[model samples]
Target: MNSLALKGNPGDGERMAIMSGRHQAFGLWGLLLLIVMAHGCAPGGSTEVGPRAPVPPVSAVGLAPDEPLRVVATTSIVADVVRNVGGDAIALTQLMPLGADPHAFESTPQDAGVISDAHVVFINGVGLEVFMDRLLASAGGNTPVVTVSDGIRLLAFAGEHADDEALADEDHGEDDPHVWFDPNNVKVWVANIESALSELDPDRATTYRENAQAYLAELDALDGWIREAVTVIPEDRRGLVIDHSVFTYFAHAYGFEQVGTITTGGSTLSQPSAREMAALQEAIVDHGVRAIFVSTTVNPRMAEQLARDTGIQVVPIYTGSLSDASGPAGTYLAFMRYDVGRIVEALR
Candidate 1:
């Protein structure tokens, strides 16, 4: 697809220039595999998924004779986080395949088996999961379920004229589900993950503790690094006007305020009305916003048009899922880093 470059302010070119150095998605995935290796063994014991995986949807999970704990996570992001804590003792099934969108993912029969047989299910709850209710009902499991983001302090989508209870849209909620975007908020998720995984597999409590501790230290460093990086933007310039409410968590965690979103509600599936678009356009001019951060999971054409109409630059970033383990936003940590780098570089 040929991209029509939208020109904005002159200095904006420098930011877009650096963004142009984007890694090829496949190549970045190769580098991502290496990074995961340093973090120690991935969860679910083995990397070798069977030649023909016979994952059933939700059914009655019977006893496994000396089998590992069966755990299922909703997305690769949740899977990666659980893998860190579960380490080698858990058999985890990720419902959504790599590079899939969590917001609008449809559950399948195999997914039923994953949820059915799992001793526990983990989800990034905060209304982030649109398929949770149906997936749970489909799974038909008796497993104790846990929401990793349940206990974390949450921020409301800070759009003045935005509705907080817009449930009609599927992909997003009034609350931002991208808490994992902020490493600190993820630390809260880790605490919940460690507790849930440990309760299921007490024998490996030490491993979970060790993994969680190490991961937390990295998160601590991540928080520090984000602050340092964000400082690149002058204090007064730290405001955001985004394609959707996707960056609400990131902006809140960092020091930026989300002045407005293109979509009137939390969901990306909802299109912006002409009236809403007009309002957003005005906000862009008022805020002196340099660029609009758009999610690659959804279509960026709307944002592109907004950029063209206003001469405000639009920069693409990974929000919902990591790039295929070979791209810039492959891992959770790297995904946040990549996004933050792009946001800071452009806004600063």
Candidate 2:
């Protein structure tokens, strides 16, 4: 995976240059000079200058001439929702592929071109896409970035999650990016997407609003369905064992407690230490967790091993990304229903 970590490393200066959004051109001669002079000073002596494409500024509302609004969504989950709101008025591109972990996602050079071409880029944000800065810099850093998770109150990592090893190297502070797990929060996303699209192309404001309204209704229904579905699991049995803290919003909204996590934190990038694993296994047993809910994006080997040791089932749940159109959990609505059904079955 060609990813740029947000840490104080030797390559930090070079990465900073890419992120600075300079219109300077590093011609062949300049690239060679940098390679020769900054060999040991610059990290890895990278001479690759990003595309300095000039992005056109967005006009005020009502710029809709004929071409559909070009939009980019960072994750498949975000793409699905953006599609719901954009409907036929926008040309949408999804950045992440199916079942890809957002935390550890690799950004390709082609992605930079895609983002540069977009009128606006929609992301889950709140620090979910760690590689976004590099990708945006590579794209020339001119596209307007919209965070759909805005307006929703984000949660902070508490107790053991506050000290997660995955976050030790990150100054991510305490905003949980997994707000989509709660349908109520998704309603906020619908509003934000609608607002962005309407502001960009006011000619189709009514269409965007209608699409948002319909999707908002569907989201409300999903919320109610989840509320009813989780009731099948008795209150005491609502303790959940997950691979990570991805379901913090789900548990908080649905009355389930995350009894233990295999990865020991909110990110799949973190590995569990032996002592942490032992403690989690003990918690699972003590809490009487029936199943270990593993995300389809992350490796299930650790989850499977833990389940074996505890004699519990490993249930796969969609997180970060969605399945293809042909599979279960293909749409955002279907994803919630499928996960809730699995959770209900496992604990009921």
Candidate 3:
């Protein structure tokens, strides 16, 4: 996929057009109405996510004018952000397909080829793409790359994760890479994306700016709505027990308490020891936590075990990727809606 920009032909426009429009519409009407009313439907839905390994951005510098910007996203969540902001101006290849975990993902030679040839690449940054250093070390792309979450107020992850080998990769000091958990942070993603795309392909600047403005407004509305919805939960109930330390940004943004996690690492590559699980279960019971939120991309077995042992309910929601076009979380906006609604539901 060393093509610059992406090939605009969606293989099937009728399907893709409907998919695109519907995905765009997923939360617009309600979110718009919510902006006025200070409310919107709570999070609800799921989506498929990204690939197995990190690939270098494949540059397609000499492709035809009709060829869209060849962009490679480290994760599907990042891909959706670029798509919403870049619109039809670029062709994006998600290095990690839906459902693949980024924290533990490995990069292959082919993946490196994809990274090396892109005209512009969007990464979540904040050490999220642990494979990035090696990928860049290999000189994967001539494509200009930018981190969408570059200027975000990255959250500090003090908890433990599952992947130790990748732990060294997150030497990002204290900044958290899971900024998408906070809509405001994702708004930063829009800006970085729009700036990169506009600069990379000046011809599409108008489109990129226009889309970014609109998407950014939506993000703001989402943040406001979250503030409103979260108000419904009592302070004591405004706490979360998650599988990994994935919700630090989300919790921080929404005024929720991070009581702790079943696993202590930044990634889910590790398993909780019997003692760790017992401790987390005790924590849940101690806090009277109503729910344990687990990302849909991962099995909730550990969470379920903890929930059962601690008498907490496990709620499944989209954390990484949007669902297939047929499901509720078919896009980034929907992914947020799905998650926030679930959180609102269990807590309220």
lDDT tens readout by residue for model 1, 68-150? 77888887888888887787778888878775666556678888777777787777765556555556666663555677776
Ranking by lDDT: 2, 3, 1
Which candidate has the top score in TM-score?
2
- lDDT for every model? 0.65, 0.72, 0.65
Runs of candidate 3 exceeding 4 Å displacement: 1-65, 138-141, 158-173
True-vs-predicted CA distance for residue 66, candidate 2, Å: 2.4
Best by lDDT: 2
lDDT of model 1 at residue 98? 76
Which 10-residue window of candidate 2 scores lowest in summed lDDT? 1-10
Error of 1 at 86 (Å): 1.3
In candidate 2, what are the lDDT values of residues 113-158, reduced to their tens digit?
A: 9998888888887667767777877898777777787678877532
Return the lDDT, model 3, position 55: 35
Q: What is the TM-score of each candidate against the true structure?
A: 0.77, 0.80, 0.76
